[model samples]
Target: MQAPQREEIHLNVPSYKKNRSGIAKFVVLPELIKSLLSLAHGNADVECGFSENAALITDDRSSLSDISINGLRATKDAVKFYGQGKVHKVPICKGLLDNVKEAHSRYQVDQEITQRILEKKEAIVAAAKLTKHKELVLVGKEQNLIGQRKILQEDLENVSKMLNEGNSRLEATVATKNFAGVEMAQLLIGGAKKKLDVLKTQLGDNSDQMNQLKKN
Candidate 1:
C-alpha cells in the first residue's frame, strides 16, 4: 500500500511598516493592507504542498482552500482590531493568515489538471497493449505510447518547476510587504506624535501671550 503522505505547513511574516510618520492609524493604512495581501498570497503559495502527489488530490490540490480559510480568519481579526481603534499589531498578522488561503486554492486547481493528463496517458498505454497487429504497427503504437509518456512526464516536470518558482516569488513578495507595512506604520505614528508636540507648543505660547496681555 502507498504510504499516506504527510504534509508540512509553514508560515512566514515580514517586517514592513505603512510609512515613517510614526502614527499608529497611518501605519495600518490601505496601502499597508494592499501590501499585506500581496505578501499573504505569496506566503500561501509557499506553505501549501506544491508536490505532484498533491496535484492528484482534488480537495487539497494547490492547498488554496487551507490558505483561504486562514486568510478569511486573519481578515476578520484585522477588521476587529481596526474597529477598536486601538492601533493593535494583530491586524497585519491576520492579513498574512488570509493570504495563505488564497494560495492554497490556486495550487489545488493546477494539481487537478496535471493529474487528469497523467491518468489519460495511463489509459492510452493500457489500451495500446491489447491490440493485435502487424509487427510494424505494434512497434509504431509502442513508440507513440512511449512518446506520450515522455510528454506527460515533461508536463509534470514543468508543473513542478513552476510551483517552485512561484513559491520563491511568494516568499520574497511577503517579505517586502511586511517591511513596507511596519515602516509605514512607524511613519504615521511619528507624524501623529509631532503633531501633538506642535499643538502643545502652540497652546503654551498662547497661554504666555494671554498672561502678558492681562498684566499690561
Candidate 2:
C-alpha cells in the first residue's frame, strides 16, 4: 500500500502594517487584526493569507485555542516563577494547549476554594467573638442575680427574727395588759414577713431562668 501523499498548500502572505514613522509594527495576531479592522471599517475588502497548516482549523477555533493556550502558559509561568510578571511566549501546539487549558481551569477552581475557606475562617472568628461578648454579658447578669439573692436571704432572716420577737412580745403583753403596743408590733412584723416571702419567690424564679439561659 502507498503512503498518503502530503499535500502542499499555497497562501498569500499578508503584510504587517507599519506605523508612519516605521519604528515598530503592531505585535497583534493576524486574526485579531483582521477582526478589529472589519469591525472598525465596516467589512471593507481585505485579503488574509495563511499556510495550509494554519488554515487546517477554522479561524475562530484556531484563534480561541491560541488565546486560551497563551493565557494558560502565562499563568503557569507567573505561578512557577513566583509572580515574575513575565509571560513565556511559547508556541501553541494542539496537545500542549489542551493540557494547559485544563490545568488553568483547575488552578482557577483551586483559587476559588482557597478564597471560600478564608472567608469561612473569618466568619467563624467573628461568631466566636460574638459568643465571647455574650458570655461576658451573661456573667455580669449572673453577678447581679447573686447579689440580689444575697440581699433577699438577709431580708428574709431579719423578717423571721422580728416576727418571732413580735410573737413573744404579744404573748408577754397579753399577760401584762399592753394591747396598743402589741397590735402595732404585730402589723409591722406581718407586713415585713409577707414582703420577704414574695422577694424570695421572685429571686428563685429569676435564678432558674438565668440557669436555663446559661445552659442554652
Candidate 3:
C-alpha cells in the first residue's frame, strides 16, 4: 500500500492513476507566466492617438497648448462617433455656439491667472537674491571690522608695555638723583603716556564699533 502511494505522489504517474489518488503535488511555476499574461497584446490604441496628435499638431500649429490639444482630440472623437468622421455632418446647436463664444473670455481669464502666478514667482526669487546679497555684505563688513579690532588690540598692548617701562625708568632716575637722566626719563615717560592714552581710546572705539556692527 505504501509503495502504491509513493508511486501516485511521483510526477510521472499516469493521469488516470493520479486522478484516482486525488490531488497531486505541483512544482512552483516561473513568474514569467504571470508577467507575460499581464502584458498588453498590442499598442493599437496608443499608436492611433499618436497618429491623430501628429496629424493635428503640424509645423504651423506647433505652439498648441495641452488644453488645445485635448479640445481638438475631443472634437475629433465626437465627430467620428456622431457624424461618421465628417465635420460638415456634425450638427451645430445653440449651446455649442454659446460655448464657442465664451471660449475667448475663458482664455483671457486663464492668461491673467497664469501671468499673476509667474509674477509672484519672480518676486519671491528676487527677494531671496536680495536677502542673500545683504547677508554677504554684512559678513564682509564684520570680517573687516574684526581685522581692524585685532590690529588695534596689538597696538594697545605694545603702547601699554612701553608706558610701564618708561614709568619704571623715571622712578629709578629720581632715586639715583641724576638731574640729566631724570629730565630725559620724564620726557620719555610723558610721551609714552600720551601714546598709551591714544591707543586705549582707539581700542575702546574699535570695540564699540564692533558691538554696533553686531547689533546691526
Stretches of candidate 3 off by over 4 Å are: 1-65
Model 1 vs. true fold: TM: 0.21
lDDT of 1 by residue, 98-142 (tens): 866777786788679878999999988877764544446656655
Give each prediction's root-mean-square deviation over alpha carbons. 46.0, 17.8, 9.2
TM-score of each: 0.21, 0.50, 0.67
**Number of clashing pairs per prediction, in order:** 46, 0, 0
Off by over 4 Å in 2: 1-96, 99-104
Report the lDDT of model 2 for residue 97: 76
- Candidate 1 overall lDDT versus native: 0.54
For candidate 1, the clash count comes to 46
Alpha-carbon deviation at 78 in model 3, angstroms: 4.0
True lDDT of residue 153, candidate 1: 56
Per-residue lDDT of 143 in model 2: 84
Residue pairs clashing in model 3 are: none
Tens-digit lDDT track for model 3 on 67-157?
A: 8999899998999987899989888999879988999999999899989999999999999999999889889988988898788788877
Order of the predicted models by lDDT, top scorer first: 3, 2, 1
Between candidates 1 and 3, which one is better according to lDDT? 3
